[model samples]
Target: MSAETPPGASFPESPDPDRTIEHRTPQPGQATANDAHTRQLPYGQAEELGFNAPDGTEGAPAKRGRGWLLAAISAIVVVILGGGGVWAFSQLSGGGTQPQEVLPGNAIAYVRLDLDPAANQKLALLTIARKFPGIKDSLSDDDPRKALFEAIKGDSPDLAKVDYAKDVEPWLGDRAGLAVLSSGAGKEPDVAAAVQVKDEAAARDGIAKLAPGDEYGLAFRDGYAILAKTQAAADGYAKAAPLSQNAQFSDDTSAVGEPGVMSFWMDLGELADMSGAAATAAPTALESIKDMRFAGALRFDGDYAELTGITRGGAANTLKGQPVKIAELPASTVGAISLSGLGDGFATQWPKIQQAAEATPDGQTITKSLEQFQQLYGISVPDDIVTLLGKSLTIALDQEGLDAQQPNVGAVLTTDPVKAQAVVTKLEALLAGSGTPLQLAKKPGDGQLVVASTQTYADKLGTKGTLGESESFKLAVPDADAANYAVYVDLDKLEPLYLSGLKGEEKSNVQVLRAIGLSGNYTDGTSMTLRVLFN
Candidate 1:
């Protein structure tokens, strides 16, 4: 059977084989064949016929001229074929460069760009725009990819004339990588990049021609061309152990998928230290995070793209376990989140919190409040707060009244009922003189404490439909028991609450949020995942 042809396409019939001609020597005195036909004749046959001469004379001048022409054509063909092969091989093997070799051992974060990010990003935006017919027409008629290329050309006119295939690709290599190095205290982090190249010498010559006497340091090692702020740094990167062999990086990469397309690794502890140095008001939570590593990858699958990552740290263990099934919330629920081992997480970071609190004026005020509470209630505030709190807590929003305009926010805390009661009574008494009332009611049967903005809302908590049984919630928060912390947001119900406040382009963005659900799971305290669902 003939291969299927696309609609509106026609398949031409096979040519008549019997009509093909056989080659033969032309008779003397016959009209000279056309230049095109003479060129197609075999070199020996053409020579014997003296076709190289204007007349039928066998002259050395004509023979030499014809020989030189044939030699030049053959040379051109060889170069074209050889260069084409190299280009094809480079594309198929993802280039010959080793990005890891050009990154320093002390690199805190490493990022590899497998494809042209600008092009990919444009394509992603186009894909999203196409998915929503309401917004698709709002997009520019100009292709985003072409627009980006034009923008780049506008910024660098010289680059606009450069040929990527002949001038850049041969030297720029397969993949490009960037490494973030921790600069000692009081210094900015250093960024270094590596480009894979086909030939180090040729790449160097090309780079020199492209950007002569540029300030950036450059070095060649293995199949990579390294560029950094300093020559020393670039040299060190060339000699240092690559990220592939680095134990910490390997650990993080294992948790997330191996590096492909695009990948990144971040050291949380180092990042915390950097933050502390950069900002005096850095959060106390950063101090508790020990040996944390986060790694992820961005991969494209046909029209869709996925970003997957994992977080692992010493504090992860203290933050493990799913305490409540978020899917049990009612369909009217806009959002629900359950966090297990909250107490443990707080306790683990309590020392850091105390240090931070002692250093700040607001923290001093909180400390004074604790002292006053102790004096009045004869209770150790810190000990009581920790003891009275539960290992898990769940906060959820449910529609209130017939209009569903007001959200009835409720929090369920799992703690010792007797201790919770004591803490509640003291809190209520403390706020009594301030004119604001505080009430914490106990949920029947579950022994969990319930707090709501309104008493009517609190009263309905026990009788409200559970969100965990909802189909949308179930699909969003799959394997709730395996998660240490989980959160589900129902955009279907939540969008209307905030959509009215948005205008112009912001209002159009809300359309993308419709029927969208977001769910995240911190599984086994060692890894975390966030999944987005759309109806």
Candidate 2:
């Protein structure tokens, strides 16, 4: 009923209720990069990538600072945009000012978004968005931001008192940012927000209009307005170090290799420290990702949008396997994923993951359960099955039997005979006596193992065809040949199947997508690219 693909993922959240920032109806989605590619996916070359077509965190903050901060800034911007002031946004591009320039250097996470980006960015956004009827209707009505402003204002009574034209427009600038300023080992993370401002005088006046007391902290720096829980915190931010000074954030940013409309970076080690203090179980599991740093960006290019991300500091696995043979997938294939390096990567890295898992009581219990199953079945699962997947593995779904009693799905695992034959023999003998034998066949000439829902598709897996040449795959995954792993969905081919399974508004939303493609290459660190192609 759905198509799945590999890809990458962002978005900021609305405010909380206790801070009088009530009503949280998130509009929908969001990010960017250019390896001439980025984000379609977090999908990997791992054998068990979660690719079911339709399938489907964190803290209270240093109290209320981050959420209330973002809420406070957005309330200001919403009022300004709703005023319908049409002065050129370029006038307030404000000498190339950015929100990060004012944020604290000790920040564990930071995210920035711009209401007004450069011309190319705006065009790229419109170009990709105009294809969706729901989104396009609003954007096409005139100044797109005004439509956005109205939607954001919605029925939230929290925004009722301020006059947009008089209170906000004359002073508001185009970009804003939110951050977890610091995550100490034992306390909640300090959080804050920065909103750009063109006029200190009117911004101060607007603040007065929004409130009568010192409920929210506020200050000014480098053409931006800083917000915090109390006046002292806001003042401190103006004088404190900025995030640009953090070395890991800079390195991960460089690994991303390109900039886009929106950017995000976070430090997991500091977060882990904060959690480790409070957590009672499996604290070492937290240790596994404690040193990792993550960076991601989102941008729109031509007909599609991309989100790219990088992970640094955590243990990384460098892969050594051939690129996927995407071009050779059968013509009838509706969706497929081919990966070569994951077999070895899993063997090398799984123990590290399992060891961390064992640190928890529940994890230890699960480990014992797995050991018992292995001993009873005479299978060293980690060694035997992993070796059996010695070479490359490809999974394909055929459009032919989607409506039949059994869907046509097949997997072709090309393995080394010497390393896998014994495991294969063991599996065959076990299954033969188990009542429910798996649908598996073998290719003697090439030592390829085939598994499918039916014998017909199992046999058809042997024929090579041209998936890479198809327009949908080509458009979604242009760099498949160079990618160690890639997954694609021929939405145009499978749309009808999905449409019948949907109802009402979901059908309309689903119609705009033509195909989705994701491709990635991993080395010291991983970088991925994803594209959501529109009809």
Candidate 3:
């Protein structure tokens, strides 16, 4: 497909759109690839798979391995993602149809959008987004979907001639999803676009205007029209299992909790294999996490937009880290990220990681180095280091920490006193040879250890602080007490750091950002939530 996918809020798709590209009739030749990296059609794989003949008629199905079909399918994936922004999601309250219903059960990845979301969702987003000039321009006065279409087409000349009112509007539905489907063959990926269609005939007609209808494969299921690179591929997808019925997908959706306006899902292992060098690596870089599934959903929460994601299955347990309380930090804190149980988790899981690493080519070299380090520093590999860090830790900063020359910052650690002190002694010995020394001492009561830029700041952290009571801190990380891992930034307070880099409009646009917060937890799997608040 000549068309490129749309771009937006971590919504993976096309490149920076050229607002200056003028619309004209598409030329009739092998379509010019929008990007230099995009491969032209793979001829051998296409025919080997028995896809449609050049004139657009079906060929016999090939019973070969998933590989043959996979390569051809990879090409199909481009179209699946062709209308990237077509699915710009909006979310408020849940309960609209999701596009996963029409996607294949064996899909490797997908990015979907809901142009029109629950009313409350839209209202909430616009309310805050309007304060920023960049987003306000996209929130057009005309129908948003129509505005989105124009913007999408403007990104590529291949779609320049397709009018939104005449071609897309009549048949286009509210939801659209772009996806890459796998045939379970470990072969290349194929792509498809499930466009929710109001009128199939109108959709077919409109599609014809975009490309010679025969060049594309079309299939219908439920109320959506599935578009593919070939008629044969389209027909196969029509008969194949859909994601809605996939148990793994269902479980993941549940694990992530609520559905939002936009969401994305992908198989980490499969995606890694697609990388050119990784495909040829001896064991593959992501071999350890190949089976892990990563998914994210976006929605509006009062004054801010929240994005939540999770990594589950295949080595997901590696993410197991306990939560800790951060409400006691000083109210003057401008930034901090705190997490608990990692020291314990690290101790528990390091052996498994070491075993896996041993299988690599550099195993012996690593072993030798660790042996030397342990002998020289008189500290065990992970034991002493992690013990010194403790079970719970918070890396925090206040205004004083922002100074370029000599900043005031510190790390709060809650740990076992006797064992940690032993490790601390080892660390102190290790640092004794260095020119610059750090301050590390215990806090008064909370069984905490503080490592600071200055001993004064370390002393300052010994008592309870009002961080939890600060407005920006409260807004950014309200769930801190219940969260195991959290990060907060007072954007307003930090504005001066970057204000010199911005000018007029750019500076004004940034001023509206009040703060940012992120919180996450791990049980059997890891899930994280992030929010960016606007003033």
Q: Note the Cα lDDT for every prediction shown.
A: 0.53, 0.62, 0.63
Off by over 4 Å in 2: 1-95, 140-156, 211-214, 245-247, 277-290, 318-322, 349-372, 417-437, 444-447, 500-509
Candidate 1 vs candidate 2: the TM-score winner is 2
Candidate 3 per-residue lDDT, tens place, 1-535, comes to: 1322112322222232321111212221112222344222211111110011111212222212222223223323222122121123322122345678877787878877655544334445445555666555444333445544443343444566778888878887767777886644445667887778889899878767655423668888778878787889878787788887878777776666544457788887767665443645545345656788888877654456678899887654644555566778888788888988788778877886787678779998888888998898889868776776677888988776685676768788787667766777677777876755544654534577776767778787766788898877776775677777899988888887998899986788889888899987787677788888878
RMSD of each: 18.7, 11.8, 14.4
Residue-by-residue lDDT tens digits, candidate 1, 1-535: 0112112222233242232112222211111112324222111111110001011212122112112222222322221111111011101112234466567768888877543222223233234334443444333322222222222223343344545455555655445677878776556878777777778877777565445445556787777787777778778778888877888787777667524356788887786666554365365445446577888865332123335677777454555445454554556777777777766667766776778778887988988887887898667646666655576677877755524554578776676756776777777877875788666554532666667656666666655466767665655565665566677777767666687888875566554543323334564435444444433
Which one is best on TM-score? Answer: 2
TM-score (all chains, Cα) for each model: 0.63, 0.75, 0.73
User: What is the lDDT for 454 in model 1?
Assistant: 63
What TM-score does candidate 2 get on C-alpha atoms? 0.75
| lDDT (Cα, 0-100) at 21 in candidate 2 | 14
| lDDT agreement of model 3 with the native | 0.63
Q: By descending lDDT, how would the candidates be arranged?
A: 3, 2, 1
